[model samples]
Target chain A: MKNFWVTLGALVAVGLAVALACYRWHCDEPLHAAARQRDALAWLTAEYHLRPEQAAAIGRLHAAYALRCAEHCMAIGEARGAVAQAEREGRPASELAAARDRVAARERVCREAIELHLREVASQMSPEDGARYLGEFLPRVAAYRHEGAPTVRLNQ
Target chain B: MMNHTNDPFSEALADWRVNPPRDPSFRAGVWARVEALRREPWAAYVRRHALTSGLALLAVVAVGGWVGMRQAHARADRDRALLVQVYLSEIDSRLVATDGTP
Candidate 1:
């Protein structure tokens, strides 16, 4: 019986040691996010030859833009939901068309705001670099903009 | 009873009973040897197996570091992909110019 207790205690101590090691080394979400953010800024700096100040400014702009985007996305989602609901209920053609038009108008507004924001970002770079960056970057964002509409419950 | 002295097994038993002259500490000596064998400290045991232990530790650290690096790399890739999406959200000027007036 005493041997059994001793063996059990030894096993428990070893288990605790391994658990502590894992806790010390494991990555958490916020740290991971921060690292990625740093990597993205680094990528921009390398790609555009951005000065330190430009990198900082662009990073801040992106952060703010992300917040604005969330808001715009939420609004767009609501408009899309209304359109979907109208269609599902077999509303009159005119009402459905009006809902569709409302979504389109809101989308146009979102697009304009986005373009203005891009211009602000580009202002930090040389004219050639800015134009090239915008040309390359805009299309990727556009691809996903409408991709999620069908799958996502945008209203929520 | 046949003549007891004539039986070889009886004679041998009688001789052993008369000459029971062995070490009484035999059992104690055996146990002491076992304790000596089992009482080494863990540090000493590890030192004795240093090469094997070091290799095992190295293997663990190498594998753990690799997994951590892969996870970090994957996370950065995902974030970069997201940044591309964010930048693209600006939409092509052509689309903005041709689509509905805001």
Candidate 2:
């Protein structure tokens, strides 16, 4: 009887986990922007006879955007490194601040480019699809909720 | 309502429309391909079996750990409660004995 109860308890625990996962994923309430992008691409190709060249071109532009973002990310890293070096040498972190400004400038450019790309995408996609894409990305820039919290929300 | 014909996906797709990119002849160069895609589609890359299995394994281990912690807590509480009950019973008997002596 004790063993039977233990087994029953285990089953119940597993059931609760499954329920939690279902609730968290929202039973399909969650949006799939990636899947939507693929669909849009396929539809564009099939509907408009968009040459592979054209599709590839847009893909390239996106790639350029990614590189720019990466550069900004790298700049931020370099700036932080400079600050660490300064601290070790008992010097002011003024050099780090200058590096930070460089990163900030690069990031600003990346943001403008992202906006331009978004404008192009909005012009190409349906209103609903545009909404879904924006919904996925805009939350990445949300302000901090608490101290020491990591702020990456591309899943929204 | 449970039939496939009434699926929500159907409704979503039915309302779908497209606005083709203005420049259809554009082609991404080698650099773009290397940097952006870096691999296959993002979905394909992320859906690797290794990653999926790793995440599932981590989740299972976490649940097991949580369950172990809860059982330990329950055991500790049970032991504490039993000790308190035994102490109270002994005190009650001594009080009865003293009442008779008085």
Candidate 3:
């Protein structure tokens, strides 16, 4: 009976340890977005065979671009909120139209920021890699994302 | 039958077999001692089966480690696929057609 308990305890301990190990294998929901960006950057660096210096520079560029992207996204979100509020209050059509225009402008800014980031990343690579990045890789990446939006709809 | 009157060893053996210990509680005392010896300590029980238990523990660790590693590898592959899905969605037809053209 004592041996049974001891063996059972050991088995439970091992089961918990294995469970924890498996849990760590997944990127958490909030971390998933960041992981995707990091993995994408890592893939690019590896595929291009970038030098340390080039990678570092491109990393900085990516960071800057991310900041700009965030700012644009925030603006778009704020405009959408304002539009919703205006609609709720039964505001003038002109006011809603202006809010819609504001949202559109922010979206355009975000797209341009993404484009500049791509250009900067490509420029940091070797000429051959840069051309392929701009031509093949960037196109494939864009086509999959549907006009540079995230997989999940931001508004929805 | 050849009877020898000078055989003292046989006589002593017969006497000892016929005349046992005179203590009234001798059998009870012997049984008590036997019971005490029969009860084993917990540590002794573990020591006796240490080899088997150790082998079982080793097997558990090996199987757990293998399963954990396999699960982690599978999750990593799935994560990589998701990252690729996110990345490749941005590509356009024109950009793909112009491979390596600056």
Candidate 4:
């Protein structure tokens, strides 16, 4: 009986070892590393295989774009507030329409600026990498709903 | 006892003798029965069927490893997609608009 239990325990240990080995073998190490990274720029640099100069250029572009995006966000927020205020005050249809249009216009400005910035960043990579990068991101930009930060919807 | 040998009954009793048929394998047969009745230990039974037991263990380990690999791969893919989404959201603000109305 003791021998049987020992053999059973040995088999279980072997199975566990095999399972752990297989899990480690199949896990995507690079992707896991990228997921652990908190910095988007660092992730992008590693994922896209960007050179030092390219990373620096994209970094600068990102900084500049971030400021522009913040400004656009502020403008869009104000426009939306105006639209809400118009509604609350029972303003004329024309005034409400104008406020809504301002919000839409701000959103369009922000979207187009982001699209341009993405293109600029892509241009810094090798032609093939740039095209690949654009392929991955351009659709998200086109599909932006101005709800918040853009996300890749896996279901879609 | 002095004159009983002359009597008929005493003569028959004196002539009586016992005889039985011989079996050459009788002792061997009894030993075979003893061996058949003996209980075998579980460990010994497994050792006796080692090939079958080893094959079963191998199959179990293989299936377990395959399942582990598939689950790990699926989880990794999900994490990768989530990380990509997070990275995109960090860079692009349009998807997360503050206002409910776009």
Could you give candidate 2's per-residue lDDT for residues A31-134 as a string of tens digits? 22212332334433333334577556655655565565555455545545555565566675676577556545644554555556655644454566556644
Tens digits of per-residue lDDT for model 1 on A31-89? Answer: 34533554555666665778899989998887887777766766677777788888788
Q: What local lDDT does model 1 show for residue A2?
A: 41
Q: lDDT per residue, candidate 4, B13-63, as tens digits? A: 889997878999999999996675355566775787699779969987998
* Worst lDDT 10-window in candidate 3 chain A: A147-156
| lDDT, candidate 3, A52-119, per-residue tens | 89989988886676566656655667777777787888999999899878766765665665666778
Rank the models by lDDT, top first: 4, 3, 1, 2
Best by lDDT: 4
Candidate 3 docking quality: incorrect, acceptable, medium or high: incorrect
Residue-by-residue lDDT tens digits, candidate 2, B1-102: 477678889889988999887764345565666665454554454454456545655676567556655654554443333332222222111111111111
All candidates' chain B TM-scores are 0.53, 0.44, 0.48, 0.55
Error of 3 at A113 (Å): 1.5
* Reference-based lDDT, residue A87, model 2: 53
Model 1 lDDT per residue over B1-102, tens place = 578868899888877855577999999999997786477666665676678656755665555556565665565555555545333533322222222222
Ranking by DockQ: 4, 1, 3, 2
Tell me how large the interface RMSD of candidate 4 is: 4.0
lDDT measured at residue A55 in model 3 versus the true structure, 0 to 100: 83
Model 2 residue B92 CA deviation in Å: 71
Each prediction's RMSD over C-alphas, in Å, is 10.4, 37.5, 15.1, 13.0
Docking class of 4: acceptable
Backbone clashes for every candidate come to 1, 4, 16, 6
Pitting candidate 2 against candidate 3, the one with the higher DockQ is 3
